[model samples]
Target: MSNKKEQLFDIGLFKRLFQFIKPYNLVFSGVFGSVILIAILGVSTPYLLQQAIDTNLTNRVSEGFLFFILLMVGLLFAEFVFQLLFIYYSGWLGQSVVKDIRVKLFNHLLRFKMKYYDNSSVGVLITRSVTDMERIADIFGQGLFMIFRDFLTMIVVSIVMVIMSWKLSLIVFAMLPVVLYATKVFQKYMKTAFEEVRNEVSNLNSFVQERITGMKILQLFAREDVENENFKTINGRHKKGWLKTIWYNSIFFPIPDFCASAVTGLVVWYGGLASVVDGTATQGVLFAFVMFIPKLFRPLRQIADKFNALQMGMVAANRVFKVIDTTSQIDDTGKHIAKNFKGDINFENVFFNYVEDEAVLKGISFNVKAGETVAIVGATGAGKSTIINLLNRFYEIKSGVISIDNFDIKEVTLHSLRSQIAVVLQDVFLFADTILNNITLNNPEITEAQVEQAARDIGVHDFISSLPNGYHYNVKERGVMLSSGQRQLISFLRAYVTNPSILVLDEATSSVDSYSEQLIQNATDKITKGRTSIVIAHRLATIKKADKIIVMDAGNIMEQGTHEELLQIKNGYYKNLYEVQFLKEEVA
Candidate 1:
C-alpha cells in the first residue's frame, strides 16, 4: 500500500542525510566523546565489582572495602554526568536536523511545478512534512544514540570478558547468534506491520481532512450520517492495522531477555564446573561474567530496536526524496524576460492534453492585443480553462508556441512570467490569516493606502470596516468564516492588488449573489481597463460588454467577435449560453 517497493537503504542516502548534521559537527563530536566515556564507565563497573569481591571481601581489609565503595560511587557519578552530556547533545542534534530538513523540504516543495500538487494527495504531503520528519529525527535522537552506546559497550565488554577468561566468555557469548537470528526473523514481520500501519494512518488522515474541509457541503446535502459511517469504516481499518503492530511487538519484545537468561544459566553452570575441576574460574570472575552477560544482551536488543527505527526512517526518507526527486514538467529557462510586456499574447497552432490519452486543446490559434478584454464562452470541457492554464504556464503545451510580446513563455523564467499575470479562479483559497494579509498576499510591501484602495475598488471596504477589527479581522481557514460573496470579493482584491499586465478571471462571479456579482463586475471593469483580461464564464451578462468574445466547442473556436456579432450569428455557443442566462433572469 506504500505504492513503493521496500528496499534496503545504503550508505549514500545516509551520507546525504548526514550532510545536514555535518554543520553541527561539534555537537556530534561531543556526543561521540561522551558516549565513549559512558561505555568505558559501563565496562569498568563490572571489573570494579570483581576487584571489590577479590581484593576487599577476601582480604577483609576495612580500608580496601571503603576505597572500593568510594571508587564505585565516583565511577557511577561520572557515568551519570557523561550520560547527561550524551543525551542533551544528541537531542540537540536531532532537533536541529529536523528543523533543517523541514526548511529544505518546504523550500523545495515551493519550487515544484503545479503538476506535482495535482498528482499528490494533500494528506500525504502534510504527513511527510510533519510525521515523517519526527520519525527521521527519532532515528538520530534516540535510535542512533542507542546504537552507539550499546554497540560500544558491547564491544568493550566483550574484549574485557575475553581478557578476564576466554573459556567462560565463549560459553556466555554462544547464545548471541541465536538471539540475533530470532530478532532478524521477527523484524521482517514487524516492518511489514509498521508499513501497513503507516499506510492506513495516511489513508485515515486523508479521509478526515477531505471530509472536514467539505463538512458544510456534507451537511447541506444531509449526508452527515453517510460520511460518519464511511469514516468509521476507515478508522476501523486503521485500528486493525495498529493492532497487528501491537501483536508483533508483544511477541518480539520478550525474546532477547529470554535468550539472555538462558545464556546466564549456562555461564553459571559451566563456570562452577571449571572452578571445581582446577580452580580455573574464580567466584569474582564468574560475578563479572554475569554482569557482562546482561550487558551483552542489552546492546543486541537495542541493535534490533535501532535497526527497526532506521528502517522506519528510511521509509520516511523515501517519501521525502520522492517529492524532492520529482522533476517539474514545466521547465523554465530562468531567462528571456519580456521587460516591457505589452501583453500581446499569441497561441499559435497550440495542442495540449492533461494526459497523453486525449487532447483538451487542439490546434488552437489565437491572439490578444495589449489592453484587450477577451471573453471566452464555451460548454463544459470545451478547453476554456485549459487555455488560461497554458497561458499561465501551469502546463506545457504538447506542440505549440505561446508568446507574450513576442517572447516565448517557455524561454522565460516562470516567476517573471507569472509576476505579470493575475488570476482569480472560481475556487478561491484563503490562508488562515487576517483579511488584510490575504488581499495583499503577493505584495507584502503594500501600504495601508494601497490595501484600502484595492478593497474599496472591489467594494469590500465597507464590509471589512464593519468587522470587529476592520482589515485585521481573521479570515479563518480558507475564509470559511465569511460568506461566499465576501470570499470572492477578497480573492478579487488579491488579484487586483498585483495590477498585472494580463488578468484572468475564471467565473470569478459565478457563485456569488447578484448584488455581489455586480459589484465584482464593476471592479473587474476597473482592473481590466489598462490591462489585457481573459474572462472565462458561462454567464452571458458578465461578458456582454467585452471587446471580443470567443466561442469554442470541442477544443476549437467556433466564433470570434463582439457579443453583438456572436448573438447576430444566432447559432453559436455564446448565443445559446446567452439565451439560457436571459431566460433565468426573466424567471427570477
Candidate 2:
C-alpha cells in the first residue's frame, strides 16, 4: 500500500539493491571487467579503419593493407568475445540477485500478522513479488551494465576523436548540448509515464484475480455482461498507460537522430574546406569522425530507451522495499517453549477490536478445563468466531491476557504454540496436489500408513479408495475437483494427522449434505475424544452432547451451562435459540 512515487535516480534505492549482489561479487566483477574491455575494443575499431585508409590504402602499400585488415579482424573477434561474456555474466548475476530477493520477500510475508493481510490487496502483493522483481532484475541485465558500457564507449570514442583532429571533434561536439538537454527532459517524462503503467498493471492484475476467484458468484447472479463492461474499462486504462510511454518515445527519439545528422553534416563541410585550404585535414580523419558521431549519439539514444528500464526498476524497488519494511508482524516475543500443554484455556478480562473503538469482544472472560468439550453457540457476528481467532493468536487482543495451562500464550514461541493446536475452519482450503500430500501436508514424520489409519477411523477411507488413485488422487486448485463435503473431510483428516493437544471446529458442519454431515459428526466425535475441543455451531442439536455450552449474544456471554440446564432457564438466550432451530428441523 506504500505506493509512493520515487525520484528517478534514487541513490538510496540503488544502494539497497546492490546489497543482494554482495554474495556474487566475483561474477559482478567479471561482468564489470568485460564492459571495460568491450569499451576499449569498441573505440579501437574506428581508429583502425582510419589507419587503414591513411597508412595502407592511400600509399598503396600491399603488405601494410593486409596487415591492417588482419588487425581489424582480430579486434572485431575480441570485441565479440567480450560482449558475449558481458551478456552472459550480467544475466547470471541478475537472476541470482532476484532469486535471493524473492525468497527474502516471501519469508517476510510469512511473518506478517493476519491483520496486515486483511488491509492489503492480494493482486498488488503478487505484482510486487513477481512482476516487480523481474523489473528489478532488468536493472542489472538490460539497464545498469549496458548503460555503463555505452557511456564508457562514448567517452573513449570522444577522446580518440579529439586526439585525431580536435577541430573536427569541436564541430561534432557543438550540437551535444542541445541533444543532452533534450535527453534530460525525455527522461523526466518517461519516469512519470512508466510509473503510471506499473500502477495500471497492478490494478489490472487485481481485477482479474478477484473476478476469477469469484466466478461462481458472477455466474449465479448472471452478471457476466456487467463484469465484462467493467473489465473493458479497466483494460482501456491499462492500454492508455502504455500509450503514454510510446508518445514520449516518439517525441524524444527523433531529436537525437536529427542532431547526429546535423553534426555529421557540419563535420563533413568543415573538414572538406580545411583539407582543401591547407591540406591539414585528411579523409581518414573526416570518415572516422563521421563514424564517431553515430557512436556518440547511438548510446545517447539507447540510454534514453534504457532509461525506461532504469526508471521502472527504481519504481519497483520502492514498492518492494515498502513491503519488506513493513513492521506489522505478529510479535513473537515469548521465550517460553510449550511442551505437553494440558489445554486449560483461560481468557481473563479480554477486550479486542479489529478497528479502533469498535469492540468485537467486550471484556470477555472464559475458562475451559483440560479435556473438556466446550461448544460456543451464537448468531452471526456475535463474537463466536472471534474467540477462535484470539485463541490462535491470529490477532492480538486490545487488552487482556490469554493463557493455556497457566502459562501466558504470548510468552511462548509461535511455532511451539501453533504446533500444539489445530483448527478446522468453515471454508476448507486444499492445495493442487495429491490427497495424501494434502492430508499429511508433506510431513516427513507422518507416514502414509498413519494417514490411512486416520482416514479409516474417520470413515473416509472407503470414499478415498473408491477413486482411481486412492490416496494419490489430485484434488486440483482449492479442492475444486472434490465436493464441499469431501473437501471438509480432507480437512478433518489433515487436522487429525497433526494430533494436536487442542482442536477447534468453527461451524465445520454447517453447510453440507446429510451424508457428509454424518461423516463429519462421526469424525468429530472420534478426534475430540480426549483432547480439549471447542466447537462453534449454528445447529443447536449437533452440540447437545457438549459438556458445557457458552451462549454468546452481542459480544457477551449471556448464558453458560449444559444444554439441558440452559434450556431449563425462563426465556434464556440458549433456550430460545434451541427452540428456533428445533422448530426449523421439524418443518424440514
Candidate 3:
C-alpha cells in the first residue's frame, strides 16, 4: 500500500538485490559464464550451418560434410551443458538470497519496539516475509538472468544478420520500433497491474487471517454470510488486478511475435530479389537470414514477461525494505549490565501514552522494595498492564525515570534487564508443540527432569502427567488442545522454571474456575515467596495480605497502603472498591 514509485525496471532494486548475490560469487559466475557461453554458442551453431551449406554443399565438396554436422552437434551439446549450469546455479543463488533476506528481516522484526507491532497487522508482515520473499527469489532465478540470456542472443544474432546482408537486415530492423513501443507500453501497464495485485494480496491475507483467528466470534454472531460477501469483493478486485496484466499480455505478446513473422516474410522476399534477381545475395546467405530473423525478435515478447517479473520483484522488495528499513527499534546503547539483578524498582513521575495527548499513565510514581509483594488493583482501563510493559522497556516512557536496583533501566542491556523478570498475563499463548517443550520453550539447559521438578514445584505436575503422552503431549496451535485454565497452568509452569528474580502476575486468576484458581493460588504462593512480585489483582479479596496495595483509576493512583491501613480510612477509594467486590462475591 506504500507509494514506493515502482518502475518498469528498478535499477535500485536490482542493485540492492544484487548485493545478496555477492556472497555466492562462484554460483553467480556460473550463471554469468553460462549466459555468455550460450550467447556465443547460439551464433556459432547457425554460423556452422551457413558454412556447411555455402562452402561444401554448394561447391560440391562432400569431403567434410559429416565433419560439419559433428561440429554443430558438439556446439549444441556445449550449449546444453551451460544451460544446465545456468539453471542449477541461478536456482541455488535465488534460494540462498531469499533465505538470507528472510532471516535478516525476521531478526530486524525481533528488535522493533512494541509500538510498531501495536499499529501493524501480523498478516501483512507475514505476506511480506513469506510471499513477497518468494517473488524476490524469482527475480534472480527466472526473471533477470533469463532475460539477459535472451537479450544477448537477440543482440548477437541481429548484428550477425546485419553483417551478413545489411539491406535485408535494415528491412527486418524497421519492424523493431513497433515491437519496442508495444513492449514499453506493456511494461508500463504491467508495473501498475502487478503493484495493484500485490496490494490486494496483502489485503486478502490480512482479512483472511483476522477472520480465521476470530472465527469463533464470527460464527457465534452468525456473520458467516456477511463475511463471505466481504471475501468475494476482495477476491474480485484481486482477479481484476490480474486481468489487467493479462489484457496487456494478450495485446503485447503478439506484437513481437508478429514482427518476427513479418520480418521473416520480408527476409524471404528481399533475399529472393538480392540473391536471384540482382545477384547481390546467395542461397546459402538466404538460408542463414531465414534462421537469423526469428532469433533477433522473438525474445522481445519474452522480455515483456520477464520485465513483468522484475517489476513485481521490485514492488515486493520495496515493501520488504520499508519494514527492514523501519527505525522503530528500542534503543540499546546502554553501557551498563544489570549485574546479579535485584528486583528493587522505582518509578519517578512517569508520563506515557500509546497515542499523542491520550495518556494512559500520567506522572505515576510507585516503588517496590526488594523481595516484597506489591499488588495493583484497578478497573479495566486503569493502566495496570502498561506499567509492566514499561518495566520491561517494551515501550519508551514519554517523561520518566525507571530504575532497578538503583541502576536506570535504560542503562542496562535489554537482555540483562528482562532476564531477571517473568510475567504471566490474563491471556496465555502457547505454540503447537510438546507440553514439555512449551514449558521449557526448547531451552537446552532445561532438561525433561528439570521441567518435571519445576511442574511439581508449582503443583501442576499431576495435571500434566494425567494427559496422554505425559510431557510429550503436543499442545497444538496456540495450545488449542488444552482448556484455557490448562494453558494458564502451562504458562505458570513456564514462568516458574525460569527462576526469575522478579515475577509479575497480571490478573492471572480472573478467567479460571475455582479449582484452577486454587491451583494458581498455590503456584502464586510458591513463586512469590522471597521474590519481588507485582500482582494486578482483579479480585480485590485476593490481595489482603500484600505488603502494600495500590488502587488506580483513570491513569492515576487513588490510594496506596497495606490492606488494614486503607480500610481504616473513612470512605477511602480502596475501602469502597473492597466493599463492592465483597458484596459481589456474597451475591454470587
Candidate 4:
C-alpha cells in the first residue's frame, strides 16, 4: 500500500533478475542480434524513399527506380524475418525465466515458518504465484524486448536524421526533453496506479477465496445475502483500481503523439525555409527528415508502452520479493541429525505468544520419559495444543528449553526434528491423491507392506479395501470422497507410517462415531506402547487410561495425576467435567 516510487528500483534487483536469464544467454544473444537487424532495416527505409524522390524520380531512370523498388522489398522481407525470429526467442526466454521464478518463489515459501502461514491468507499467496508471476512474465515477453528494439531504432534513426541535415535534426532533437519529461510524469502516475491495482487484486482474491471456503458456515447461518453484499463492496473497489490504471495509460500514450506532431510541424517549416533561402538543405533531405520523424516516434511510443509494463512488473516483483525476503523466526543451528532420536521430551518453563505482550503459554514445565503416554485436558484456549505445538517446534517458546533426548529442539534441523514427531488433528486434510500416497506421505521410502500395515493398525485398511481400486483409490480434495471417520483414519495412517518417536493427538477421534472412535482408540493404544505420546482430549473419558493426566486452566496446570486420582478430589473442574460426561453416557 505504500508509494512504490519511493522505493529504489536499484541495480541489485536487476542483477538478481538477469541471473535467471544467464542460462539462456545464447537465445538472448540471438534475440539481440535480430533486434539490431530489425532496427537497421527500419532506418534504411527513409533513405530509400529519399533516393526514390530525389534521383529515381527526377532523372526518370526506369532501371534506378526498379533497383530502388527491389531494395525496399528486400529490406522489408529481411525485417519480417528478423521479427519472426525475435518473437520465437523472446517467448522461449520468457517462459523459461517465469518457470524458474515460480520454482524459486515456492521453495522460498517452504523455508518460512508456521507463523508466516498463520498470519497470511491462502488467496494472497495464490495471487502472488499466479497473477504476480504473469505480470513478471510480461516483463520478459514484451517489455524487455520492446525496450531493446525501440531504443536501438530510436538512436539509429536520430543519428541518421542529424547526418542528413543538422539544422532540421536540431529542431526535432529539441523536442526530446518534452518527450522525456512527459514520460517521467506519466510513469509516476502509472507506477502508483499499477500498484494500487495489484494490491486491490490481492485483497479481492482473498475475499472471494475465503468466502468460498467458508460457504458452509454462511449457508448454515443463512447469511448468503449479507456475504454477497460484502463481496460486491470489495469487488467494486477492485474495478475502480483497474479503471484508474487504464486511465493513466490513456493519458500516457498521447504525450508521445503530441511531442512528435509539434516537432514535425517545426521541422517542415524551418527546413523548407532553409531550402528556399540558402539552397543548403535539399528537398530530398527535407523529405527524409519528415519520414524519419515517424520512425523516431514509433519506437518512442513503444518505449513508453514498455515503461508502463515495466512499472507494473516492478510492483509485482516487489511483492514477490517482500515474501522471499522475510526471515522465519525459527532457524536451524546446523546441529541436525537423521538418527539417534529417542523422544525423551522435557518442557522447562516454556512461555509463548502469537502476538507481542500477550502470553498464550505461561511458564509451563513438564517432562515426558522416552516412552511415556501423557494426556492433557483443558477447556478451550487452556494451552493444551499450544504445549504440543511448542514440543514440535511449530512455534518457538518465548523463554524456555524444549529438549529431545537431552538435545534442545532449537539445535536440530527442522526436517530432522519434524521427522520424529507426528500430529493427527481434528480437521484432517487429504489431497486429491491415491490412498496409498496419502498414507505413505510421511515416509515415501515406506514399502507397500508397511503402508498396508499402518492402515490396518489404524483400522482404515478395510475401508480402503472396499473401494474399487483399493489402496489406489482417489480421495478428492479435503477427502470429500471419504466419510469423516475415514478421513480421520487416513490421517492416523499418515502418522503411523512415519514410525515416529513422538506423537500428538489433538481431538483426533472427536469426529468419529462411537464404533469408529473405538477402532481409532484401539489403534492409539497400540501405537503409543513405546512412543512418547501426548493426547489433548475434548472428551475427557478418551484419556482416562493415560499413564498421566494433567488438568489445565488459563495456561496453567491446576492438577497433575491419574484420571481416577483427579476424580477422587471431587471438588475441582476436572471432577465436574468427568461427572457431566459420565451422566450423558449413562442416559444414552
Top candidate, metric lDDT: 2
Model 4 lDDT per residue over 313-358, tens place = 7778778878878887577774768474777888888889988998
Candidate 2 lowest-lDDT run of ten: 1-10
Q: For candidate 3, write residues 485-532 as lDDT tens digits.
A: 889899989998888988988856666799888888888888889989
Write the candidate numbers in order of decreasing TM-score: 2, 3, 1, 4
Residue ranges of candidate 1 with Cα displaced over 4 Å? 1-9, 269-278, 338-340, 583-588
Superior candidate under lDDT, 3 versus 4: 3
lDDT for each of the candidates?
0.83, 0.89, 0.87, 0.82
Per residue, candidate 2 scores C-alpha lDDT tens digits across 93-151 of 98899899999999999989899999998999999999999999889998999999989
Give candidate 3's error at residue 493 in angstroms. Answer: 0.9
State in Å the error of residue 427, model 2.
Answer: 0.7
Could you tell me how far off, in angstroms, the CA of residue 203 lies in candidate 4 after the best superposition?
0.8
Ranking by lDDT: 2, 3, 1, 4
TM-scores for every predicted model: 0.93, 0.97, 0.97, 0.91
* Root-mean-square deviation per candidate: 2.7, 1.9, 1.8, 2.8
Query: What are the runs in model 2 whose C-alpha is more than 4 Å off?
Result: 1-6, 586-588
Candidate 3, residue 116: how far the Cα is off, in Å: 0.8
User: Model 1 — TM-score against the truth?
Assistant: 0.93
Runs off by more than 4 Å, candidate 3? 1-7, 586-588
Give the C-alpha lDDT of model 2. Answer: 0.89
